[model samples]
Target: MKLLFCVYLSVLFFSLFSCQNDKRVENENSLSIQREKSKLVVEYRILSNVKYLEDRNCIEKLASCKNPKAEVRFLFPKNISELGLDTAYQEDSYFIHQLGVFNKPIFNEDENYRIYVMTFDYMVSLVVFEDKRTKNRTFTITGKAKGIFWINSSYWIVGNDCHMGCSMSIERIKDPKLLKPTKEQNLDSLRKQLQRLPYEEKMKIVRQEGDELLFSANDTLYNGIGKKLSGFIPYQNSMILVFEQYKSNKYRFIQVNEDKSVEHIDSLVNGKFDTRQFSEDDMITILPKNQSLISLCQTIFKIENDTLFVYSLR
Candidate 1:
């Protein structure tokens, strides 16, 4: 009887332990699936193709010129319409489109030549250029784009310059079912959360004659009307806000408002610039300081020299 009772108790104990383990495993699996489903999906398409210039010397000269370090470099004739693809160039703004893979020249001529390159993933064309004069001067302009795309899928399109440098913009191929918060929504939520704090806590964040609110990490209080916040700085505790504050006239003030509204409060030197709504994190702002231009995340703002900078405990 004693041996039978022992076996029954042991079995019951094991059964309960197994049930708990199974529940934990199931929860973990559910979380993993949710994470996977929330990821954004993107697709790319190319839209147009054409051959514009045909001069062999022009083509060889342009191609042989060292590729610019920047992405989306543009070389335009002083008289762009002289290139002869007047209609296409006009429609696409001097034939400026997204840059893509370049193929070796298929043919060359003294007056005209042809080289193949992918303008976008979808549109591949052979461009032909001819010069009437021996001095065929062209201007090259280059810039970069920064954005996000899907890892597993090709989200770039041809016909327009799409991906440049570290920047890539993606269009959704399929609706992303994830519930990510927008800037406004996140700001509102944070505001509500902050409102729930004691008035003393809120008062600690007030700065610049009560025009701005700040949250600090090291118990320092910063105050200014045009103070800047660092771009999209994530909080470490997931409860605190991490940002950079403006120090002088050289910076712009970026604020994540109580309502989750992000804006640029431009420097007084820039003529009392108001804040503009930005939806994404890829945007950057350039500020002209004394002699050099400083580039920083759009989240920071410049303030008056007299305003005191404050920091507070999160």
Candidate 2:
């Protein structure tokens, strides 16, 4: 009787252990599947219906579209005075009046920077400066869509009477590889992780409080038009709110602590003070106005080993 009882207990113990192991494995697999599905969904949503224009390939494709309404027309080709327009056209010698879906060379020589045309349902636009300065010059072409919508048709109308005679062309090229969202994605992930933590724990990292003194001031510091807060960089126990106080000038950095207090860091005289990042030995700041700085306008911020690095946006 004793031996039978011992055997029964051992079998029951093994059975329970096996079931627990199976449950653990199933849960892990479920989590893994969920993560993969989330990633695929985000990638598809971000990249769908997006086309890239590189080199001079799309120019011919744009010009060959048979859509009569989508035709590229040069509205004013004779002279600027004849058009009687009141828009600022800087660089009068080499200005583009109007462009449709056709691609063309923007600068004097092909310094790897090429412009492409894109048309949407509501507007026809151009994606210019795709070559070397791809990030900075990737601007949207916004205007009313005139003609037909056909498969692979890009068209643009040129403005007549411009300094340089307007022209349009197209070519075929492969799409650019999917670009990983480096900083933005990482920052969003960090914020999500931080938000998951308990409220008390999050407060320990960064506290939020209002400053009535700063809000009440009506001085030039806050009086400039188009002044708005853009973003911030949070460091060890502090955060910096980047703002555009003036429409023409670069962004200004205002540092804030965990207690919600804020202060302005002095602008660097010769050095540009665009973005702020903390370093063990010293803090690295990016300034846009520095003429000697090579990528003055295109800087990215990254953190490594608790040290922050600032990159210019040129």
In order, the Cα lDDT scores of the candidates are 0.22, 0.25
How many clashes (backbone N, Cα, C below 3 Å) per candidate? 48, 32
Candidate 1 overall Cα lDDT vs. reference? Answer: 0.22
Give one digit per residue, the lDDT tens place, for model 1 in 1-314. Answer: 99786565344322221222321233112212211111111121111121222311111122323553113212222232342212222111111222223322221222221111221111112111222253231110011112111212211111111111011111111112111212232322333454365534433322112111111111112233323322222111111111233444233333322222333333223221111212121121111111011112111211223221211100
lDDT of 2 by residue, 1-314 (tens): 99786565344322221222321233112212211111100000011121211221111222335553232221112222222322232122121212332323222213343333332211122223244554333222222111111112221211101011111111111221111111222322433454365535433321121101011111223333114333333334433334445444455544433322444543311222332211100111111111111111112233334433443321
Cα distance off (Å), candidate 1, residue 73: 6.9
Worst 10 residues of 1 by lDDT: 286-295
Judge candidate 2 at residue 74 and give its lDDT: 17
Deviating ranges (above 4 Å) for candidate 2: 1-221, 224-226, 268-298, 303-309
Q: Cα miss at 102, model 1 (Å)?
A: 14
